[model samples]
Target: MKILFVNTHYFLPQSRGGMANTLDQLCRGLADRGHTPGVLCAFLGSRDMFGLATRARIKVAAMATGIGAAHDAALSYPVWRAWHPVDVLPALAGREQPDIIVAMGGKVVQVIDAARQTGIPLLTQVHDVEFDWHGGDFAHIADVPVVANSQFTADAYRTAFGVDAQVIYPFMPLDQYRTDTHRRVVTFVNPLLRKGFRLGVEIAALCPELPFHFVGAIPDVDETGRELDRGMLALPNLTVEPFRGDMRDVYAQTRVLLAPSQWNEAYGRVINEAQVSGIPVLASTRGGIPEAAQDGGILLPADAPAERWATALRRMWNDETLYADLCAKAVHSASRPQLQAETQLDQHECALEAAINDHRAAHLSGCQLPA
Candidate 1:
């Protein structure tokens, strides 16, 4: 089957976030299965970042809109209506002639009319809870099916828009992450407040004896317009590392992974990555962290004090038997049937096929779709 991904943002070979990474993996998986896959995205100069080898694997059709950084805001319905990809979509779709159209992220509704006009089955992939602001207006479009990344997100959609979405966990290439390297340091990625940066700093400050690595670029200022905390930097044991595309290097040196997110995370991909590496995670019980962690890691309340985080870190570092037991559980949990790439891909394929059949039936029966 030929599938076309209508992405609002650039879908690069090595994307930073879960949504982009999942799309890249899905496209590659489809291509490997002898199916043709292409992407229609907003031009964001991401193509220049792709190396010669990565650019050759997938075909991309980027819409050229002269508006610079405003393109990112185009996911908003008002912004999208004024600067939508409607003009370019038909032409691109005509050339690719995809069997099914998968619109990713909150900008799915932007290409709904074009997909409808082309008479192609459209499936919206919802990644987060803020879809109401993104593309919730046309979510009730009868022929379009929605696929949520997790049960938490699926429930949110059901409650907010009465959309019973199919839950398909995001795909992570487990084979590539599997390793025999010994773990050593505790690690944290993307040190933003919502991701528990402050808490991580406190944990690092309290456990000054153990080495802690904070990966990813740090923002100059936080949400409150205050200078970013430099306390973590002051600690002799803490090392700040830049964002890395390939996480194997990060996991290689990580004894425990910290995901102390304060906000309700839709899905914590890092938790899965760490678990697959046989590294136990110490994360807050925010949204899907429990689900992501499964039985692989320890979870504290989202509002857990700095002392609690510090105590957990100290125990993991000092208690060799406990650490080994958690490591064994982490490996076992990651090896669960649901976490497999094949299972995820199979569910995705089934959802797409069912969407095509359902859309065709609705069209043939002349059923009036709900607005």
Candidate 2:
């Protein structure tokens, strides 16, 4: 099937975040499976919308009007700016008629007009609570199936939009995260001290004997990243490194992955990545994190004192056999191979197939909204 997978902008659909990486992997996987998958994104900031990566899987094009700033708050009036998938219609003229169009978020608005014009089915991948938070008007933008990356997101859609959404957890390329053995380091990625570390530092301070390493920066958001750095400057046990995509080696040196996120995470990629890398996790029970943790590690309750985290860490360190057991479970939970693709070609094959199927069957037979 010929598929057109669109993002509001090019930043996503890259290796940076789970949402974009999921699409990138899926699109490439679909292409390998013999489907023609093309990408339509906006030319934003300094990115090459028509860069080689986007060019390789399918035909890539950038529209003059781009969507919201990549990490902006929520769906606001000018958040998307003039971004709309409608403009890409001219570039897509006479292109192989797409059987499906799969989009992740408000970016779906960009392609709704084109899908209506062509009668192609549309499928939306909801990665967060935005659709539900914004209400039903957003539902009209797509006449296709909606798939959320986690139950949290799916439930939000049902409650907010009165539309039932299917659960399709985002796929990670596990091969990149595969590890040989569990290590002794305790690690955190994209460490923002303000978000959760007031407690994390207290925990680390309580257990001065253990090693705590913070990896990754604020990512697309510069101010938050800098603020996190400023907060961490005084701490000696907490070593902060700029963001690095592949943390398998880092995980190899660490026995536990700590996610003390204070946000309402729809689902966290770090939890999965750390698990795949064979690191037991110790995290705060916030948002969809418990879902991501599954039964893999210890979940500290929201209001649990930082000293509780310290106690858990000390227990894991002393009980070698218990820590080993947790490591084994983490590997098992994250080792699902059907999701990961080694080569770019294999990644697109799987992504395109799912995107195409979603486009075709996502909506009710007559294209009516749920009653």
Candidate 3:
């Protein structure tokens, strides 16, 4: 089967985090299984383009999907709208005529509409609750079948829309972490401008004796990082290192992963990455963290006050047996078929096949839109 995967965020090779990595991994996995997959994303930055000025400009301009106003704004207008109908995806679709289009989040709603215009079916992967902003407007284009990253996200989709979705947890490769363990500090990996980072910083400051390293580029880090550096350094116990270079090194030296997210965390990949590193995680109960943890690590209430988080950190630090148990549980959870590629790809294929077949039946009965 040929599938065109649309990502509204950065899909470049070096792009960081879940959305980009998931597209890269899933596309590769599908290719290995004899399915052809193509990716489309709006370019945000440019580099090494002295001889490719026009191409760089086109790439940069195609990335503007919508205006941002809300605190959690990835769900605004589909970011790829600038390049949609006639941009990269249409060119690829005209050439490949993909069997289906799978959109990861609300940012790709325009991609879905354009594909539907070409009489191709769409499969939206609801990564977070759409009601957050993009969900409601995008719901008008809800003719496509859907997939959710977790039961939490899936339930949120059903609560907003009347339809339920097939649940597919994001899969991660664990073999890379097998022989790497250089423990010393706590680690948090995500965009530093987010609430996840703020909460993480607070937790790290609360436990000053243990170093807290954040690994990820922050847009406002130069100005904000300088300010944060000063404040964190003043504690004499906290270290705010801008996430630079390979992340494996960061995970290697980290004993524990901390995600004290207060808002806008659809699912904490840091929690899962920590599990792969054989480290225990102490994360807030938000979005899909609890669903993702699955008895793997410690789960605190989403609204647990800062005082309680500090107390929990102290308790977790002191209890070796509990820490060991959580680490073991994390590994056990990671070992499951759901988190691995081969197994996850199989689940994806089975669900896609079933959904496609069911959709065909509906089309034949004049229930679904004609392709």
Q: Which candidate is the best by TM-score?
A: 1
lDDT of each: 0.74, 0.62, 0.65
Better of 1 and 3 by TM-score: 1
lDDT of 1 by residue, 13-79 (tens): 3336667677777877767777776666644333453333223222221324332212122121111
* Worst window of 10 by summed lDDT in candidate 2: 73-82
Candidate 3 lDDT over 1-371, as tens digits, reads: 87767766654333576666666667767777888766656544335452144244454554542221111113211222223332456555665577877777556566676666666666888776645445236677666788888888777777777667888887555564443777677767773554455566567667777776666664445434454543543556555565543567778887777776666566766567668767878887878888777787777876777668777777767788987887789888777777887888988897777757766777789866659
After aligning candidate 3 to the native by TM-score, how far in Å is the CA of 255 from where it should be? 0.8
Winning model by lDDT = 1
Candidate 3 regions off by >4 Å? 47-88, 130-136, 191-193, 219-236, 240-246, 362-371
* Better candidate number, 1 or 2, judged by TM-score: 1
Number of clashing residue pairs, candidate 3: 2
TM-scores for all predictions: 0.84, 0.73, 0.81
Candidate 1 Cα deviation (angstroms), residue 319: 1.3
- Residue 365, model 3, lDDT: 90
Order the candidates by TM-score, highest first: 1, 3, 2
